[model samples]
Target: AELEIERWKNENAPPNLPELKEHLQTKKTAFVLQEKRLKRLRLLIDSNKFAEARSEISQWKKTGEDLSGLSEMILNLEHIEKSDDIVLDLKRGLAWQKYPDSYIQNLKMAVDRCKSIQSIPRKSFNWRIPSKDELLLFFTSNIESKVQYNSGSYWSSTTDKVWSDYNWIVESKSSSLVRTLKDDYKFVICVTDASSEMIYHYLDTLKF
Candidate 1:
């Protein structure tokens, strides 16, 4: 009699478990569809399809769809493009033909200022001044020459040819020679103000 009562109860119970399972499956499908849509939007933006990407965003907005991911993607793409544009502009400006005459002159003036700040010391008695050949060789090899003698003072010549005329005279001594060179000669036909240290550093940085 107890077994029969148990069986009857089981038969009469409502079948709600299948309904709950179906609802959960439907939610999973919707989540997957949203993820795919977001991925496509990102791809479009990355490929520079801004118009189509923007249109998709508009549709999402009208449908009251969540688009936090898509909006962030678009913002990131725009930022990357802006940064690239600035870098391209600087590169183009550095090219001899691309820069305006006034800009080049300004750059030269800045270099001159850096040179004025450099230190120059008289040659010591023991160490000899480099000869013209030696100077040329040093310049070609891209090496700065420093002469230290028994006296407490030492003299240094930048290997750059810009100061070759003033080469005999001691000029600026700051280690940041490249910045000086760039600032002084960016616009000049002859980069006479460039320092050996600057040229060496520039070449070394290039691994050339």
Candidate 2:
């Protein structure tokens, strides 16, 4: 709309048609307002605020303004929560399980438990118990990812250097890591590395 108004202004004289000039100016103003709203929508998406982004799109639609490709983008946002319930972090080369396993047990068994899920999500992520550093990534990424786990005190592959039987575990509720004995019960979340080709396809789907 803004470009159209600019073209009209360039091709026509301003004083000859006052009504047309007013219409063009009005269109330019509306486009600017929409551009601002679109910026906000992008910010929301970048922050992993899909629910709010959906609301924004709905409200915009109610106003009767076309969002062009953005509307289709929102419509297909379900691609993130595909059949496997995996969320991809292409930048980190990781695929995170959207939910944790229900059987919260001793840390000693966490690794083996996670191994069972390796075949899930097409085994593309090679899912298994994450390392301490890898698990730490979850804490920092929590806000930026749509994945959420109900269980807390997740086990990590990294064991305590000082204690042979202790491993570091992350608490979902507190977002903190604490060293715990192998016998301590905790939840499990599997993670795997993402491939470059997978990233390419994901980006292609989003048309970004």
Candidate 3:
């Protein structure tokens, strides 16, 4: 009778028990690690180490971790930062950031950093190199003459459609439009529509 009952229990047991156990263990381990990370991030935030916290989140994303909850929290923090930003308004429904250089100096890095803001439109620019004609006309205009700015080379978003590797450029000293390779990094000045939030989060770290 004992032997018969043992055989019955075995037959009724769930199939693939080993696989299920492995999967459950994997999930448990992941949960534990996630909890540890969450605690660390919270500590970082409380300590006013937001940059480190943001860097940690970025590292996790690069590792392909599911960070939706953390990302949402960070977004809330960014919103607070945005509200505190010094947004400058200009004529003709235009907005400009007070500082010229971006937190990340490279063109691609600048663009990518600009794109991270959810409060603003997608692919929003904090700075861009003005077009040759635009820069020329701008500097030549009475309005530009009144404003004191240094003459330098700046990066423009205008890329040659026919040549994917080339981009248009403007020199503050002259009005001619020039073409350059995409890899060359140059100075950038950002502008936005009047409605944009124009948050420059890294500006606080800058001395100027």
Q: lDDT per prediction?
A: 0.35, 0.66, 0.52
**Ranking of predictions according to TM-score:** 2, 3, 1
Residues 1-208 of candidate 2: C-alpha lDDT, one tens digit per residue: 4565467676864564568767878777876876777678667766656567767867763444344444444433433434457777767767777766777888657777666773443323455788987777777775225776765678888889999899888887666889999998888888766534443343344411
lDDT of 1 by residue, 1-208 (tens): 3344446466864466456556767777776866676677657755767557667766652444444444443443343344311111121111011111233333335334324421211110011233333333333332332211121111223335664433221222322123133223232211112112222232233210
Scored by lDDT, the top model is 2
lDDT of 3 by residue, 1-208 (tens): 3344446566874565556666767777776876676668667766646667777777653444344444444544443345433243333334333444432245675565445444443333333444554555554554454433456666677778899888776676775677877787766655444321222232122221
Q: Where is model 3 poorest over a 10-residue stretch in terms of lDDT? A: 199-208
Error of 3 at 177 (Å): 1.1
Model 2: lDDT of residue 116: 73
**TM-score, every prediction:** 0.30, 0.50, 0.40
Roughly what TM-score does model 2 have, to 2 decimal places?
0.50
Among residues 3 or more apart in sequence or in different chains, the pairs in candidate 2 whose N, CA or C atoms overlap within 3 Å are none
- Write down the lDDT that model 3 would get: 0.52
